[model samples]
Structure formats: structure tokens, C-alpha cells
Target: MTELVDIHSRTPKRRANEAMMAKIGKLIWALLLLSGFTRAATAGVLTGELDNPSGTLDDQFVYTLSIQGSFDGSPEFPKVDGLDVAVGGKSQNVSIINGKYSHEVQIQFILSPQKAGNFAIPPIKLTVDGKAMETLPLELLVSASGSPRLPPSASGRSGAGAGAGAGAGAQAQGDTPGLFIERKFSKNTAYVGEAIGVNVKVFSRIKVVGAQKDFRYPSVFQVKDKDNQKSNVEVVNGQEYNVTELESVIIANREGEFTIDPAILIARVAVQRRSRSRSFFDDLLGPTDLQEKRLRSESQTLKVLPLPTAGRRKDYSGLVGAFKLSGDLNPRESKVGDTLNLSLILEGQGSSSGMADPTLPFDTKLAKVYKDKADYHEELDAARGIDSTKTFRYAIVPERSGPLNLGQVTIQVFNPLIATYEDLKFDMGTVQIEASGAVTSAPLSSASTPTAGDTAPAADTALPKPEQKAVEVMAKDLVEPHSQSQLRGSDIITSSDWTNGGLALSLSLIGLVSTGVLAYRRKPETENARMQRANKAFKHSKKHLDFAQQCLRKQDLPQALKAAQTCFKDYTGAKFGVTSASVTLRDMESYLRSRSVSRETLHELREVWSALDQMIYAPPLGQNPTRGEELLTKSRRVLEQMERQCGRS
Candidate 1:
């Protein structure tokens, strides 16, 4: 009995101990679950890498920072002592895998070594869900001379950075021996509107994959056709190099001292990467990398003097070249009130594209005159530079029946070489006219007069009489009236008469209402058509402006300037219902004046056009990246002003 009691007591104690142990185990399991949840919430990775771990001091490399998993904000880069960093590009990716979301953000920076030494790129910091994360530090060794040591490729990396690196990478490579650019100018001093030649040469000792160039000059100067000459091998500075020459013609529009910016050439050179393997197969399969090298030419200053004002002619046409003038009157005989055609041709060389139509001096005693717009044609001549011809046509109506003189035509042009003004004259002689014997109601034929270079026969002075054609008449049978009372006197009243009168009145009222509705509908349709035309004009102008901006970004001064000018010209043409090619600077000025455009605005427009023209005619000294931006802004403003004026009209 005593042993049984003791066993029962131990059993109760054992049960109690078992229950306590179970509770403790449950608590431990809960804690482990909570820890796992915390880790899942804070899970993230940050890493950094360099494209090239070791390179020359003049070399440039790409530094990349990548973050994987959920992040709160962007990564913050700590400034390094010996590295110059520029943001190259950025990309992001988000995906769901196995029911879990993953996010990645990668940023690329262009790293240029400032000096030759070992440098540590500091760790970058970021916050992921309020928890701090740090990236691994990168080591870079820059020497004075040698090929760069490339690092192992990173996982999940894209090759877009390589494409962006093509242009800027040239600067990442240090000063390469036997590679440079030289700039030469025909003359340092010139008169305004004088043509100048600029030559740019590139020398390279290494194999080049591709090249990009940025050439810029002052706004006061104009750059013309840029010719890229065939490259040839040459020896310079005791080294053989592939030499390329680019030639451009430039003209200064303003008289002042201006500095031509330095031209920059970026070349992508094929470089062989060092391989660690000594095996023959490995050597044969070694990788090749493209390294960028930049060469810049020295900046130059030019002095431009204004044209001389002494002995300037009153009829001077602002021409600065050699030219000749000729005039002729078609049909030496005509009757009074008949139309006579007058033709004048101006042909020559030297800044011919900039000349305006020559003024014709006709005597008032000759006839009543109506002048047409002059037609201009230009061609590039290797011997004389730019050859041009302008033809002006006029229609004159004789008022008297006697012999009359057509008067003299005078044109004055400035000879830049001799610093003198030369006057060209054309005498039209005389013509005979007879009084009209009979008045005719027939309209004149709508045929055009013979153009200067046309081979067709001259149009007849009188309209051809129309031939009369006879037609056979057809007979029709007469129908009898349904009601005899309708043909009788109106004194008799009938129910049919009242019905017909009421129906006729109703039909007349309906016709009047329909006419009013049609008129109302046509008005809005006309307005809508006008609005659509206006919108189209605005869109076209914007497209040209956008193209100009793109050219500016590429550092293409000539194309950018041309696009800007074309934008304005297109807008003017659309608003005025004229072809853009037919509109000259003078015509634009006249149109703006008619629109009551402010004098200040006009002056601004002139300045912009002058600058653009200069760029088109002459090569500037240096590259100015910001010049395109400024021109773009100005052009946008000018276009806006023009839009407003057109809207008001």
C-alpha cells in the first residue's frame, strides 16, 4: 500500500513537468517564425563594380551601382578623392518569380581618373524599407601608361552602356601618342560678307572604328558646304598616321572680334584586351574592346572689319560679288491697251545667293506697268564658287499710240576685291503702239509669257476668236390643262384654287427655311477648314523646330541653323499661302511689316537669320554645344510670336 501511493505522487509531478516543457517548445517555435518574417522584410542586396579595374590616368571607365529587392529611395554616392564621376545612364526592372516580387535598379557613372595612383571608390549607401544598405567598395589602379585591366562581367548586365560609351569613351583613354587634330584658317582678318576657308585635319596612328566630331563657331560667322576629303596615310612627327581633312567655307556677317571655339574629335579605337590564358586557342579567341580617344584643336580669334562707306552708291543692292545685267522687251510693236512683256536677267558669281532682285528704272511716260516677283536660280560652280541667275518679268500696258521708250534698267553691285561699286545698265530702246479701233468683250487668254530660259514660242498678243457651232432644234408637243377654269378669268372662286394657293405658299416657306439652314451649316464648315489649316501649319513648324533641337544636340551647327531658318520660312509660307522657297528675307520682312510686327521683333528675326546664314556660308572656329540650345530657344520664341500674329490675322 505504501509503494503504490509513492508511484502516484511521482506520476502527477511528471505530468506537470511534461506540460511545462510543451509550453516552452511552442514559444520557441513562435520566436523562430517571427525572426524569419523580419529577415524576409529586410532582404535586399547592394553591389558596385567597375568596367576596368586598372587603367591609365587619362583613361575613363564605367562604374556601376546595382540594387536588388525592394528599396525605399535612390542610392547616394559618396564623393571619391581621385575620381570624376558623371551619371551615364540608369535602368530598372521589376518581375514576379515563384509568387515573390523582385525589383532591381542599376545606375552607371562615367569615371575618369584624375591622377595616377591607387584609389578606393567609397561605398554607396541606400535605405531599403527604412533599413540601411551599403554597397561594396571598388578598387581602381591608374598608371601613367599601359592598357586598362578589365574586370569580370557582372550578372544581369546589359550592353547599352557600351553604346553610350562610344562617343565619350575617347576621353576615357589617356593622351594617345601620334593622334591629334589640327585646325587651320585661311586668314585671321576679313571684311564682313567676305568668304573665308577653314580646314580641319585629323591624324591617327591606331586603327579607328568610328569617329564623331563637334565643330562650332561664333554666331557672327556663317559656315558653308563642309567637305570631307578622302583619308590618306601620312608621316608626321616621326610617326605614320592616317590623316583626314575636312574643309568648310565661312563668312562673317557682323564686324567684331570673335573667338572660334576649339573643335573636338572623338575616335573609337579598336583595342586588344589582355588575356590571362597562355593556351593557343585562348590567344586566338581573345576579346577585342573599343576604347575612345579625344583630340581637340586650339581655339582661334578673328577680326572682322565693316565694309567701307566712302563712295557708296545710292542704288547699291547690298551685293558683294561680280555680276552682269541684261534686259529685253518682247514684241517691239503693240497696240494701245495691249499688254507687253519685259524681261531682265542678272547673272554672275560671289555671294549671289544673298542678292536681292534688281530695281528696274522705267520711264513713266512709256506705259502703265505691273511688276511680277523675280525668279532666282543658283548653282555651285567649282571655278567661281557660287553661280546664280535672277530673272525679273514685268507686264506693261501701252496708254498712248505713238513710239515710246521702255527706259533704262540700272543695277549696282559692290566689288569687294577692288573696294568699289560698279553700276550695270540695260537700255530697252523703244516700241510702237497703235490705238485700238474697236472694243471687244472677249477675255484675254490665260497663257504665261516666255521665261528667260524657255524655248517655247512667244504668246500671241491678242486672244483667239471662239468658233460658233450650230445645234439642231427639237420640237415638243403641248399638253392640255387639267382644269379649264384655271385658264379663265380670276373673278370665279373655286375650292381647287384655294388648295393650290395654300400648297404653293407652304412650299415657298419650306424652301426659304432650307436655304437658311444650308447657309448656317456652310459658315462653320468654312471656319473649321481654316482652323485645320492653322493647326497643320503649327504642327509643321514644331516638327522643324524639333529637328533643329536634335541637330543641336549632335553639335551640328550648320544643320541646326538650317532647320531653324526652315521652320520660320515654313510657318510664313503656310500663313501667307505662298511657297517657302519663293519667300526671301525681304519678302518675310515685308510680310511681317504688313502684319504690324514690332520693330524690335523684326530686328531679332533679322539677327537670327543673319546668324543662320553665316553658319550656312562659312565654317566657324570651334564647337559650342550651348549655341544650339540658345538658337532653339530663340527660334521657339520667334515661332510663337509668328503664330500669335497669324492667329490675329
Candidate 2:
């Protein structure tokens, strides 16, 4: 055999330097994981399932009921046909998610099949804290021991995290152990510039408290991670495993066949020490060692096809997906030189980077338009890939008075499914412009060419320019003019030196007196300004309500609800001198109660507030503008009530 090479050996100092560099790399890797973790946190949820739906007469199985959400009491398992069930063990998990405390409890039941047969477990119902909750009906099937049931699917694929439960070790006797990671692509083939969803799942039979992952893939455009990842319990080969998913999107930049490399995950898993004397109680409170495991996902291949050039449109921005665009003018009425915020919101599922902000088609002669900026926000949906919204805010300044027409706005998108281009159009309609309140001494620029400062609201005085009156003297004339006397009179000190000195002293005294009068006048004006701000709270809230109603008319429910919610928060903050973010429902109630608001009124107001919160945060109702309209109305009523009780009091 050939002698092995020893080229890897290094000097002592070099080795030390390498070790130090490795430590620094590990620290950076840990920090990156922590940063990604905070941005993807989600609130709690509840779920239940049979750990192993399919097993043999001699196999081990379990039914797990997990409550990650807020619950006061435990759920009692009910009887199911053809199966004997008993409480086996309980586990509690406490973790910090995004700086907030999160606690979850899982109750496991030992499931033993009574004669090998198919069985249906009826819905398990329970009353927790006076709230009725129930789990979905589950199905289980068992076979004879001699003919072991080939698990529901190919039983075993192993990697890291979790151990075999009970006799699960015996059932999957010859399979690999540890946590298993699997990758599934949404589509095996895609058109050029099409977006594809990439999902990777880490399945573990043991508890995986923490994990760090890195994914490698071929060239793509604008790959973005999903906003949140969720974990749930799944069964594999008569064993219960916790399943956590990692989701992302990859854009096909060019047409060709590409193979994505395996993604890797480093997980921290707890391994229990199994003993013949160990009981369910011992298992619940048993000693376990935390071990780090490395898992790699199976590589996947994708085929990207070139788009047909025949149907391409000039305005197509290489975007592929189902998308729609709509726009509306904010504060529809404006002064001639005032900047009008023209907002265009484009929302749908597609390649985010492919859709560039379309150039506005507004007639420059009527109004000068320039893009302020664009904002992109997205909420991940497993089915649609992503719910993406891009908002383009353009500042428009009207050059001419009267109803200035910004004309029509339109966007073009490519639909990969149909191999065609879609033109989404929006009518921008006319906006009334009141002549600018202030007059300028200089000639005004044409609408097609706004002045440099026109992109923002004019900082000129709103009260208009002061009249330029010619004075009888310049700075040099501040002195009594040196005698412009005729040759004889001018020669002599035509004006007395004492006269010039006295005149200067008198002028100085007048200036000082005027300054004193102005200073005295500002004292009560200062107090009035303070009071004015407090009095305008109700007005500002009402203005927000109006804005919400406008959004509702445009069928933008999310924006409308947000505006309505802001209306309430702003009113409370301004009136109570508290931070808007600190105003909560309970805080508002306490403040109102102190104001002597009746209990009945408070209760009614509470209902409205809760409904607004639900609609704004977790809306159960469908995304329809009617529900949004109702919120606007109710929010307006709440603002009106606050005004009636607190205004002018």
C-alpha cells in the first residue's frame, strides 16, 4: 500500500493560529443563527395526533396531545374502539422566543392495540379554563406480529435528534437512528425567471430544543427566507418525532437544469438513558445528555425552461406570478405647490425582484412627479408561497390650479402559467388643487419642470411674502447723512454733531422698546400653542378615521384597519400624554374608569376594541372590504365617544 501523506501537519504556532480562527468562525456562526431566530418567531398553537398511526400487534405506539398555546388545565383522553390507552408520561418545555417567555406542555398516552384491526378514534374533547376545545378524530391500523405492517410510508430515514420510543427500537430494528432531514421541492421543473418554493423538514423522534441550519443551492435570484417556521409532532415507524420545517424561495434566474446541494442542520438533542428499571415516571424525570448532531438533507434537482419571446411585452419586467396592482391619491385635495402622496400598492405571489417600480405615466405638464421610495413587505403562506406587497409612494406637485389630472397608471407582469404578459391598469383620476396660499416674488417654474424643492412641501412662509417697502436709508444712511449741504452750509457742520448723536440714541431706544413689546406678546401665545395641541387630539383622530374610510372604499382592508387602529392609539396618546405604543386595552380601560366612565359603556367599548384587535392582528373573517368598513365605523364611534367625554371638559 502507498504511504499516506502527512502534508496536513503544521507548526505549533500555525496550529494555534488555526485553532483560534476556528473558534472565531464558530462564534460568528452562532450569532448568525441567533439573529435569524429572532426575526422568525411565531405565537403558540395547539395540536394533537397519534404518534404511530400504523403498527403491528407487538409494536409500540403513542398518542400525543400538545398545547403550545395558553391553557389552564390538562386534557383527559377518552376511550377509543379496539385500543387500550393509559397515561404514560408528560413533558414541559420552556424557552425564550424573541425575548418573550414561551411555555409548552405535551401529554403522551401509551397506546396498545387490542386485536389487530382498523380503528377510528373519535374526537377528544375537553374544557380548559371554561373554554371548550377538541382534537380531530384520528385513524389507526394494526396488523399481526408475524406480518409486520410496512409502516404507512417507507418507515425509516435517520439523521439527528430524538430516540426510539418504548419498543419502537424493536419495530424499526435495522434502521438508522437519530434526526432525519428531508427536502421537497414544490416543482421539479420551472420556466426561466419563475419562482419555486423550497421546503426542508427536520424530523426527529427525540426532543430537539435548538438547531442551526445552512442551505446551499444553485444560482438563483433574490432568495428570501420565510417570516416564520413552525414545529409539530409527526409519526414515523411506530415512533413519535417532532417535525420542524425550514422554508425559503428561490428564483430561477436563467433557463437550465440545476441541482441544489444538500442543506445542513446542527441540532442539540436530549438523549435519555434507558434502563430496565425505568418507569414512565422515571422517563418523565430521567437524566439525559445533550448531544450535538449534524444532519444533511437530500439534494434536489430542478429544470428551468426558457420563456417564449414571441408573447413578451415591452413593459414586462421579467416577473412571473399572479399579481395585481392598484393605486390611490392620499389627501386628494391639495394646494398648488403642496406635495400629494400618490400611493401604488402591488400585491400577489411572484418573484419580488423581478417586478421593478414601473415608471409613472402621469402628464408632467399638469403635475411634477418623482418617486419618493418603495417599501416591500410579505407574509408567508404555504399554499401560495408568499403574500407579497410592494408599495410605491410618489410625490406629486401640481403645477396648475383646478382639477389636475395625474392621468392613468399601469403595471405589466408576466404570468408563467399562461406564458403571457398581463397589463394591470389603474385609473389615477383627477385631484382638485387649490391655488397656493402664498405668492412668490420670482417667476414660477412650469409644471413640467418643478423647482428643486418641489419634491417636498414648500418651506416658504404659508402667510405669504412680506411687502418689500423701500426705506429712505440703507445701512450707510443709518448714520445721519454727512451733511449734503450746499458749499457754504455743507462746509460748516450743516447738522450739529450733538443732533446726530441724539438722533442715533433715540433710534436705539425705539428698537429696544419694540423688541420688549414682541417678547411680552409671546408669553400667552406660548400657552395657547400648548392648549391647541391638546385640543387637536380629537380632530387628528377624526382625520385618521377619514383616511381609513377612504382605504375601505378602495377595498384595501388591511390598510383601512391599520389606519382605524392608529386613530384610537393616537387619540389616547395625545390626550393622556402617554406613548402611543404603551396604550393597551387594559391601560385604556383603567384610564377611562378613572375618568368616571360608566361600567356599561366601558364593557361595550371593550368589545369594540377586541374586535378591532382581532381584525387587525388575526382576522378570522375573510379579507373583505365590508368587514373593514364596519371596523372603520366602530373605530370612528369610539373616537367620537372619547371626544364627547374628554373634549372641552
Q: What's the true lDDT of residue 397 in model 1?
A: 92
Worst 10 residues of 2 by lDDT: 167-176
List RMSD in Å for every model shown.
16.6, 33.1
Q: TM-scores for all candidates?
A: 0.48, 0.41
lDDT of each: 0.68, 0.66
Tell me the tens digit of each residue's lDDT in model 1 across 1-649. 9999999879978999999999999999989987876665346777787766877754567676777667766555678887787786676655444334455666768777788899988788887656687878888888873342221111222322211211111211334554666666666776777666666666676667666566788877777655436466655434456667676667788999988876776666655433221233334543444555555655678888888888776767877667898877878899988989988888876565666655545566667888898888865422234556888888889888988777687777776667787887899878888877787554545455556786755477454557778885675566664566566677566799999999999999999999999999998998776666656786788999899888877768678878889988887777665788778889888987888888878888887887666546543223334445776798788778767765643
TM-score of 2: 0.41
Candidate 1, lDDT over the whole model: 0.68
